[model samples]
Target chain A: MDVRHLSLPELREVIRRGQYTGPTPGLAPGYAQANVVILPQKYAFDFLLFCFRNPKPCPLLDVTDVGSPVPRMVAPEADLRTDVPRYRIWENGVLKAEVTDIRDYWRDDLVGFLLGCSFTFEAALLEAGIPVRHIEEGCNVPMFVTNRPCTPAGVFHGPMVVSMRPIPQEQVVRAVQVTSRFPAVHGAPVHIGDPEALGIRDLAKPDFGDPVTIRPGEVPVFWACGVTPQAVAMSAKPEFMITHAPGHMFITDPKDEELAVL
Target chain B: MDVRHLSLPELREVIRRGQYTGPTPGLAPGYAQANVVILPQKYAFDFLLFCFRNPKPCPLLDVTDVGSPVPRMVAPEADLRTDVPRYRIWENGVLKAEVTDIRDYWRDDLVGFLLGCSFTFEAALLEAGIPVRHIEEGCNVPMFVTNRPCTPAGVFHGPMVVSMRPIPQEQVVRAVQVTSRFPAVHGAPVHIGDPEALGIRDLAKPDFGDPVTIRPGEVPVFWACGVTPQAVAMSAKPEFMITHAPGHMFITDPKDEELAVL
Candidate 1:
């Protein structure tokens, strides 16, 4: 099945029934996709504070009521424990298990947070006729750990991680303007030309994701990445955490334009 | 002394020294002013979630760390305990005392939250040649309790409160366009032209703040007010709560233009 034309509920149902467990990049193109983070109630305050303090990297979408598997604001009809394509369970900062469903791990004291992802803004950039190198190369966007420090909150703190895309010099301003419309997603570029200014030493290698080509007349534009919260959370070394595996995301009900401001 | 010429730190110092306990409308004109909410650590998470779910009425500016009075993001040099000119201490939803300082009541487990106020966008509206009736009349803006229910978070739920300004019908669209630039403050009008639509019975009788005249050619425009969170928090009847006296806001270091998007 192509699966690209499925409705929001149909797509969630397909994932819920264990029929699909793959990357959700283009499956539901217009809808907003989210990065999931589940933590115990004790650490929920600090983790939320971290996201609030560092909004560029962690634009929070919706937070579930404690111990409930429903993200009330974004997609209340969807069951978080089974709807996502994949889940990574972590214990004491270490990756413990990868599974399609987390019904067995769901506890009464857990809180689920859904954060906005860059996919929303990338769609906007493409619509504006700006090239997104990773989409053009048919691979993951390059991500780098920067020297920029995130504001420390309670038990959460770390350096910001940013995703890099190579855009032609003339189109850089357009890219910034296009993405600035979606602050709910990572809006605007954090850095434009110098990689070393962010203390990122090499373009060929990245702390996460695949490296892509930066062609002539194109410059490396960096955006705050969704991977930041995961890295920061791991650094905190909580007793237990659950997140969507790389490339596996939770699809939301609202269209990408719904997140665009003005 | 004319307080308008004082810098951010100086203005805070004036309030800190108990020399200024009056309403802070025109003083330090360019900088942003914030509504203050200080709650015990036990209720901080729910309140933050409440603010997160409802951005228009409660656009969160910055939240202090647990047991800390310093709002690290907005004004690190100022202390929440003494900077605000006046504070209302509440016990079980009832007003306990109205004082100039909270140091005597401050506890190690309290967290301070700074929420964006309409003052930021009002300046934008004024700069755009839009008439703000309250400022013109030298009185508080009219506020009405709306039928619109805010998306409820855990232990927090209530109707949204809105402040009204009568804009000339010719400038309603411009009013929206001007205010839309600052989402950090109450962004855009929630309703326009009709009070009955928002379940407001009488323009002369507002739930809070003094009602202004609706001129022959003017339309009453309503924007989500900063009072919603305080009203909702009071409705929840937590053990203890502290808030800035209405119109006496916390002055932030950033100017109004800094909150503008695009």
Candidate 2:
């Protein structure tokens, strides 16, 4: 069965029932997807401030109330516990268990955060006729840790992580314009031409995800990556945290167009 | 002395020493001004979430570290305690005192928040040759309690407050186009015509600020007001709070144009 044609409720039901436990790339095509982060209430203020300070990497979509599983702003009817395809439980920066549901680990102090994912902007890029190399290569986007430091908020502090997309030199301007409209979803490129300017040593070897080909006429454009929060967590090492595993993301009810500014 | 010609640091210095304790409008030509709010660290998270949920009314400009007076993001060297010309001290929903400095009132667990003000967009509208009625009349912009409800977060919940401006029918589209660029400010108008639609029955009697005459060819336009947080504070009644007194705003280092999106 084609998952792309399914309604949001149908798609969420399938994921909740353990029918499909895979990366949520193509499912629910036009709707925005989110990167989930659950932390104890003690760490929530700092994390929220971190997102507010470093908006490019951490464009907050919606934050759940303390102990509540509902993301009231983005998706009201959705249950965060079992809606996502996969969940990662982390203890002191180390991955503990990958599960289909987090019912057993739900605590009253846990506050869930849904951050905007790149899938929304990539769709905008494709619509604008700009090529997304990672999507073409059928692999995860190349992510690298940059020398640029993110503004610290309490216990949250780390280097910014960025994702690289090779666009033709001629279309770089258009790519920037298209993505700039969606500030809620990591809008616009951080750096355009030189990777070494960002203190990146090698383009072939990325810190996370697969490296895509950089063609002769293409320019590497780096955008603030969604992996930044996870990378920050790996370094900051909060006592406990939960996130959507790898490519698995929580599908939202709003369409990608709704997130655009004008 | 022409206050408009003073540099940001110079302006700040004058305000710091109590040389200038007047309304900040037309003081600094192009610099952005912020609505200041200081609260105890305990209420910080809920207030931050409230701003996040209600972006239109409370577009966050910068947030200070706990017990720190400097707003590092928007103005690093500036001091929040002494920079703004005047501040209001509130205790249990009642106004306690209006003072020039908050140093004596500052506590270790307090946090400072800088929210975007309409002054930036008003300047933009003026630059576009659009007439702002309040400015023409030399009075405060009229603000009204709207029927629209802001999304509640934690302990903060109330009706949205909006400031009204009269614009000619022909210039309404341009007014929106110009203001839309500065989403960091209030952005576009929430309501274009008919004050009654927003539950603003009589334009002559505003809930706050002095009312201005609406000319024959002009229509009332409402934008989310910075006073919304204060209104919410009035209703929710946090234990202690500090806010910028009316017409007195904190001058930020970044230029108003810097806050605009392309």
Candidate 3:
């Protein structure tokens, strides 16, 4: 099925029916896609603080009211439990099951947080005529667990994770300008060049997503990735947590243009 | 005393020693002044979320680790309990005391949040040759509680409060441009003209702070004030809260230019 042609509600309904369980990179082209993180009421405070303290890595999009599956701000009518294309069930920070829907695991005291994803910014980059190597190569954007540790909050503490993209030397400044407007989605480049600076050994092999080729004269530009909190969630080992499966993001009604500032 | 020449540490030390307990507008000319909010760990999450959801009204600068007296990020050596010129002690959301020091009320479970104050942006406005009537008339900036309710988070909910500055019709665009660079502060104006649109009846009679003269050929520009979350705190009525009193603020080491974006 060609999901790219569907509207926001149509796409969500398709995912809700379990008819589409795929990554959401190219779907709903201009709309914002979010990283999902749901935790028990006990860990909600610490986790929420975690996002506030580390905004570049965890730019928040919308948060659900306590025990409510609805993301009241981003997509109120949408049911988070079943709308996302796929869900990851983690027990004590260990991924135990990947489910098509999380209705069975829904709890009375869970708080849902939806964070801004880089897809919105990536679209901006592509529109500005800047090449997104991963999109060009049809691969996941390369992600690395940086040595830079995130500021800890309560029980949540871990190193920051960053996603890297290659851009020609002339386009680096343009890339920064385009992304700077979208601070809600990993803003500007954390590091412009040199993987060794971030403690990454090889550009060809990423710790998380698939790496793309860096063409001649192209430098790897690092942007704070939404995946940092997920990694932290696993390392901190909360008793229970739920996250969107890799690349299966929760789509929101807000357009990419709305996320831009200035 | 010529307090204007004092460095950040020096100014803070003088404030801590109780030698200075007055408004901090012109004291540290280039440094950033912050709105202080101290809450019990239980209410910290809701308050932080309130700031995140309403960025214009509550642009957070630094949030300390839970139960800590130090603002680790902004000022590590600075003790939040006594660093500000004055503090307001609240019980069940009602102001019970305004003191220079909060040592008697300091608790182990309190979390300190430093919110970016408008001083940074106002300084920028003046540097750009845009007039700020309050400063010209030697009074407090006029503030109004608008009809727009902040995006409620947890138990915290209240209308947004805005500080108004009348700018020449020609300089209104310049005012927005200058403040836009400082998103870390309250950023750009939320409402430009027509006080009644925000449900504010008399622009001359403000809900808080003293009103200033609006000369001819000028339109009142309203920016989301940092005072907002404080209003929310009182109305939300958490069990205990501490904040900076009136114009007294926490001055930070970072310069005004450092808070600018892009």
Candidate 4:
């Protein structure tokens, strides 16, 4: 079955029913997919502020009301506890369990945040004829922790983490133009060339995800990665945290075009 | 004294000392003046979501940590509790007091938010040779409550409020081009012509602020007003609310040019 042809509700239903248990890349093609973060109400304010301060890495899509499982704005009918393909439960900043649903661990104080994911912008890049190295290599995009510190908000503070793509030197301008259109999803390149400038020592050894080939004519372009917020949240070592494991994203009803500003 | 000549720190010190008690208009020229809203932390999450939902009316510039008096991003050294020239205190949705400073009423649970004001974009308009009718008339800008309902978040929900200026039909495109550059400050006009289309029965009698004249050839242009969030916050009738009194904004360290995107 082609998941791209399925509607948002249908796609979410499949995930909810445990029929789909895989990374959501290329699923529900035109719909927006989000990075998920769930924290107790006590930490909601700081996390929200963290997203606001570091918009490039944490462009907030929608935040569920405290104790509520439904995301009123983004996906009214979907349940945050059961809608995603996979969930990672973190206890005191350490990953404790991976599950298909978090219903057993649901708490009244939990506040869910849906952040804009780069998958939306990757689709935009492909449409604009810019090559995405990770897509070509059939692997996760390379992500590295940079020396740049994110603007701190309360307990959340950490260095910025960025995802890298190797773009031909000639098409760097086009890559920036295409990604700029999607500010909600890690818009524009943070650094177009020179990985060392951001304090990344080795391109071949990424902190997360698989490293893609960097051709001689290609320049390594880096974008503020969605992982920064989750990483920061983890560093704070909150009593509890919940997230969609890696690329197993939460799909929303909003179309990818809905996020475009111009 | 020419307020434009004064440095940001100097201007803030004057305002803090209560020596400068006038409206912030044309004061601190080239610096960004912000619409202030200080609310109890209990209602902060809802209000933050409200601003995020309605970016046009409430383009959030900076938000302080709970119980903190400093606006760390926009005006790090300025004290939010007393830096503004005047403040309006509300209790149960009723105006309780209008004071020069809010230091006496500051609480540990309070959170300060600095929202972008239209003054920055207005300055851009004037620089582009487009005449702002209200500035020309030497009176407050006319504001109206439109029939359009804002996307609500939690307890904060209300109709969008808009400020109007009469522009010659020939310069409408230029007005849009100039204003679009300052998305942080209300961005482009929501409606360009025909007041009746927005359910605005009479242009002369505004819902808030002073009314400006609409000349024979000029069109009534409406942009989302900064008052929407404050009005929405007031409508929720929280136990407490604080805001800048009309034109008495909180001047920030950010320059007018910094808010422009291009």
- Candidate with best DockQ: 2
Candidate 3, A130-197: lDDT as tens digits:
99999899888999988999999889999999999999999999999999999899999999999999
Q: Candidate 4, residues A17-129: lDDT per residue as tens digits? A: 88887888888888899999999999998899899999999999989888998888889999999999999999998999999999999999999999999999999999999
Instruction: Summarize candidate 1's per-residue lDDT along B96-190 as a digit string, tens digits.
Output: 99999999999999999999999899999989999988989989898899999999888899999999999999999999999999888989889
- Model 1, docking class: high
DockQ category of candidate 3: medium
Is 2 or 4 the stronger prediction by TM-score?
2
Worst 10 residues of 2 chain A by lDDT: A1-10
Question: What is candidate 4's lDDT per residue for B34-94, written digit by digit as tens?
Answer: 9999999999988888888788999999999989989999887889888998999999999
Give the DockQ of candidate 3. 0.74
Clashes of each: 0, 0, 0, 0
**TM (chain A), candidate 1:** 0.98
Quote the positional error of residue B14 for candidate 4 in Å: 1.9
In angstroms, the error of model 1 at B213 is 1.4
DockQ of the candidate models in sequence: 0.82, 0.93, 0.74, 0.59
- Model 4 earns a TM-score of 0.94
Error of 2 at B138 (Å): 0.6
- Specify the poorest-scoring 10-residue window by lDDT in model 4 chain A: A1-10
Q: Write the per-residue lDDT of candidate 2 for residues B108-219, one digit (tens) a residue.
A: 9999999999999999999999999889988899999999999988899999999999999999999999999998898998999988888888999999999899899998
Report clash pairs, candidate 3. none
- TM-scores, all models, native as reference: 0.98, 0.98, 0.97, 0.94
User: In candidate 4, which residue ranges exceed 4 Å CA deviation?
Assistant: A1-4, B1-4
